[model samples]
Structure formats: C-alpha cells, structure tokens
Target: MSEVPQARRTCRRCVLPESPPDITMDSEGLCSVCLEAQSSKPQPEEELLESDFTRLLGKHRGKQKHDCLVMCSGGKDSTASLYYMRKRYHLNPLAFTFDHGFETEGALRNVHKAVEKLDVDFLFYRSTFMRDMFAKIVTSGSGAILCHLCSMWYMQVALDIAARYDIPLVIAGWTKGQSAHQGTPSNGAGQAGNREYASMSEATRRFLATLKQDPKYRDFPQSMEEVLKRARRRHKAIVLSPHWFLDTHPDEYVELIRRELDWEYPDLSYPAKSTNCSLNFLAMHLSLKHYGYTHYHVEQSKLIRANQQTREEALKDLEFNCPREFLASLAGRLGIELPE
Candidate 1:
C-alpha cells in the first residue's frame, strides 16, 4: 500500500504550483504568471522613506485619543507594528484584535504581553458571526478562499473601530506584499489590476456572488471595491503599514519583539515560520485541495520578486508539512470530517 502523491510540479521562478484555474507551466517549467510578469511594463515605483512615515505620524499625532488604530493579529509583523507604534514612533495607538473563534492562544498571548508591556489600550472583539460562513465554505465546496473573506470582514471592522475613536490612521502589520496605497480598497482590490492577483481575485468575487443569495449574508460587500465604498460613506481613514516605509526586515523585528515584548512564534503553522491563526491550517489545506496553492505562495513570490527574500528561502518556507492528525483535529472543531 503506497501513500498518495501530492501535486509536486512548481514554477521554476516562483513557488506557484502547477494549477489549471490560474497557472500553467511552460516547457521550461516556468509558469504563465512568471512569463507575463516578465513581459509587463514596469510601473513607476514609489519610494517610501522613514522620513515620510515620521512626517505622517507627526501630522496624525495628538489629533484624537489615540494617534492610530493598530490591527494586531498576534503575528510577528503585527506585534512588531504595535511595539513600534508605542515605543519607536512615540504614538499612542489603540491595539485591536479580532477573533472569529479561530485565533490561536499563542497569538493572543503575544498580543496580551505586548499590550501589557507597552501599557497601551487594547480592544479584543470575539464573535461567532463568521463561523457559519467559514463552515459553509468547507461543506459547500465553494472553492472560495477563506482568508479573503475573513480579511474583508476584519477590514470593515477595523474601519468601524477607527471611526468610533475618531482615529485618522488604521495601521496594519502587512509586509511589502500586503501593503496597499493609503485610501485604497482594503482586501487587495488595488492589486486586482496586477496580473498576480487577477485570477485569485476573480475566484473570491465569484464565491462572494453566491453569498448574496443567502438572506443573512446578502448585504455582504461583493468586492473590496464595495467594502471601500461603504467605508467611505461611514468614515474616512487612511490605511497604512509601517513596513512599507521602513527598510527593516522581519528577522530584525522578530528579535526585537521577542527580547522587548516577549513575543514567540506559534507551535503550528503552514508554510513554516509564520504566525497564523489555528483556522489557517484548515484554510491552507482546503486552498491546496481546490487551487493547488495558497495565498502564501502569492505573498512569498512577491517577496522573492522584490528581493526581500530569496526563491530558495521562499520555497523552503512554502512546503506543505502539516500532519494528518493535526489537520483532523482542526477539522473536528469545525464539525467536518476529512476524507480518508
């Protein structure tokens, strides 16, 4: 009895696996995405400097009770953002965490330590509103990306929190790959025009379309574009990431947070070395079952292209090493049984 083989073919230039809905490999083992990226006209890049970040902070500082609303996911990127907001930049930020019942204890612990050490105000919102939606994605086999929908929901929540506090800036721990221009759409709509996000965005849109038929989820924004529109009507806040303006790498900041804030990595996560929620294990498994790859592949590929990380390093981190029993445990929580 031999074990079943997983999809192993991948693009030579990036970590994208050979998947049909969006990716195809050439004879040379390069993917269509890589080829198109190579041929596309390079857009003029905006160089963000530390001075720009300082200036922006100064302008927004002391305008309200808090200078900014920092979204802390208990991940290294976000935890570091919270640390910097209070200590390095000298801004009084309101630390916000949204738990859809899938957040890991490790992540929450990191957040708890950071807020206590920094002595900043903290807001923790936990709800089951998204639990049904996530379960639907799994049972219905909608092939929708869970992370995309989750991001949309949380982004809206973050915007509302910022507005309630009259904060001018909604800060995120997004790396260079996740950062978008301020005042743009929240869930990667600004990047929809880019070739890399086109297919994935379309898939997410199609899944959201189906949601409109359900009475409970009918009002769900169909796209990040729509999310931004609603946000503008309710409140105006600029979304920013300190990582976009700072040249510091995760290696540098991970150490900083560990030493200064007592932040530690989680025991379990996909693609290795990341600090994702417990639900992320299920999400990555389903994503691979449907799309042959996950959003992490897209993010790491971008980092490789930007020279922030090497292809070899990204490849190593992108490996799917989750054990069967661990996945079953996560699925058991969702009341779904994994296929034998």
Candidate 2:
C-alpha cells in the first residue's frame, strides 16, 4: 500500500495551513498572527471618543451642493455612513456604486433599496470595459496578482466618476485598518484644511506603485505625470474615509444605523453571501490560499487592534469561508477560466 501524505498543521489564528500556504514560524513556534497581536501599529495614546458623533462628521458637514460622492457598497459600513450623512449630518451626497458584474442579487437589491430609501441621486457605473479588463487579468492565471488589478480598476473608475460629477468630497467607508499606512487619513485631513491640490505627489506615486506591483499590474508604468494630468482634469476631490471614525467600534455604529434606518439583518450579513458582497469571498479565498491570510485577516486585524472587533471575532472571520461550489460558479459568471 502507498504511504499517504500527512496533512500539515494550520495557523492557530487563521485557516492557513503549513503546506502550500507557506506560513512561517518563529522560534516560539508562533505564527505571524501572534506577532501581529503583540506588535500592531501604534494608536494614539488617546483617541478622541466622540459623544454626539455629529461633531465628528467632517465629510458631511457643509451647505455646498453635491457635497460628497459616496462609493457605497451597501454593506454595513457604507450603509451606516450613508445613514449618518443623510439623517444625522444632513449633507447632500451623490451616491455612486460600481457594478463589478459579480455583485450578488442581495447586494444589487440593497444598493437600489438604500438609494431609493435615501432618495438621493444615485449613479450606477457598470463597466463592460473593466469587466473585460478584469476577466483578462484573472484568466491570464497570474497568481496573486489579480488583486491589484481589481483595486486599481475600482479606484480609476471612482476617480473618473467623481471627476465627471464635479464632486469635491469623495467619501468612502474604508476603515483605519486599511488606511493607517496607506496615508488616506493624512490626505483627507490635508484636503479638509484646504492646503494643497488633492493630487498624488512623488511619495504618493511611489506608495501607489507598491500597491500595484503585482505581476498583472507590474508592467504598467506608475507615472506621476499621467496621474497628475488626470487629477488636473477633475475638480478638487478629497477622499474622506468615514470608516476611520468607526475604527474602534464599527459594529456599534452599524447597530445604531440598523435601528435608525430600520435596516433588516440579512441572513448573509458578515460571513455569508447575504449582507456582505459575494465577490469579496472569492478575493478573500485567493488571498488566503496564496498568501496564507485572507484580505479580511490583515484588514480585520487592524480593526481588532483598533478595538473594532474582539480578537475572537477577528479569528473567526479569518477562518476562510470560501464556498468552493459557489466560487466555481462565480468564475463562470465572470468569465474567469476554471480548472478541469
């Protein structure tokens, strides 16, 4: 009889295993998650905990027409932001959502539902151009590189949409977990203070280059000249992250919105195909299978350190709930090639 290969052990924190996922161990036999918990990015010794929360509403506080262009995904974060802005801050925002072709029926319905309920002027940008671009990127079988393409495609589209609308403030629900090192809050504060053009500088260009260094996006030149040219065409657009404020207790804020907006808790809110977007699971799976951590692990870890979620909750989310059957079907829908 042939000797069967023994299954390797996985990280105690996440779903990553020791086999092909390549999780490294320290002298203590601890994984990276243990290290991350011990040494997270330092937070301010004192976070200005908001009481009224209206005092913290910089993105929505203005009488200017078309005050903000919100990239809402109809998830808890974006939906909470919208409710806060419209009901609490009373800002006039032009809501925008990118239809990435893989948005589940729930997400689509909720997008339209939220927009209608808010009664705001909403724009849905469905790009066959980007659909083909992403399809080609994924089908090319460039492992772990397609993530950059996905991010860049959305950002470029958002910029184009914001520019066309002449919207000054581009609001998003990006939590501080995703923005701490990315310089988003820094850029947002600068824009709020009206110091300089909301354009990418040499340093910013270099940072963006790191983000797009995946093989799929590697050949593309990261020219500040071209980025600047594009920025020049737009009115001053400052991307403000509402999620930054909710970094400590995002679910608390979401619950508040749930009550205020009378929002129904869908069956697939966080870990399933119900509330959260479905396409995210596929990306999460790829990130986990290749990098040994889902995007949610890195993202949620930051939030956990920031006190948004408990370590237990973060660990649960990092367990990688990729519905294998559903993912194969999604590949077909998005024209991504499937292995026989």
Q: Which candidate number would show the highest lDDT if scored against the true structure?
A: 1
Please give, for residues 162-256, the per-residue lDDT of candidate 2 as tens digits: 77867766777765534312322132333332111122122234444553656545544344233334665765576666656544466587677
Error of 2 at 194 (Å): 29
Runs off by more than 4 Å, candidate 1: 1-8, 180-193
Candidate no. 1 TM-score: 0.91
lDDT of 1 by residue, 1-340 (tens): 1121366588888888787756788999998778887888866778889898999899989979999999999999999999999999999999999999889898899999999999999999998787777878877877677788888888888988988889899999987646532222236535645554555566667778888898889888776667767888877898989998888978999999999999999987766988888888788887777777777888787677667788999978877777878877777777777655
| Backbone clash pairs in model 2 (N, Cα, C under 3 Å; residues 3+ apart or in different chains), count | 2
TM-score of each: 0.91, 0.71
> Against the true structure, what is every candidate's RMSD?
2.9, 7.8
TM-score top scorer: 1
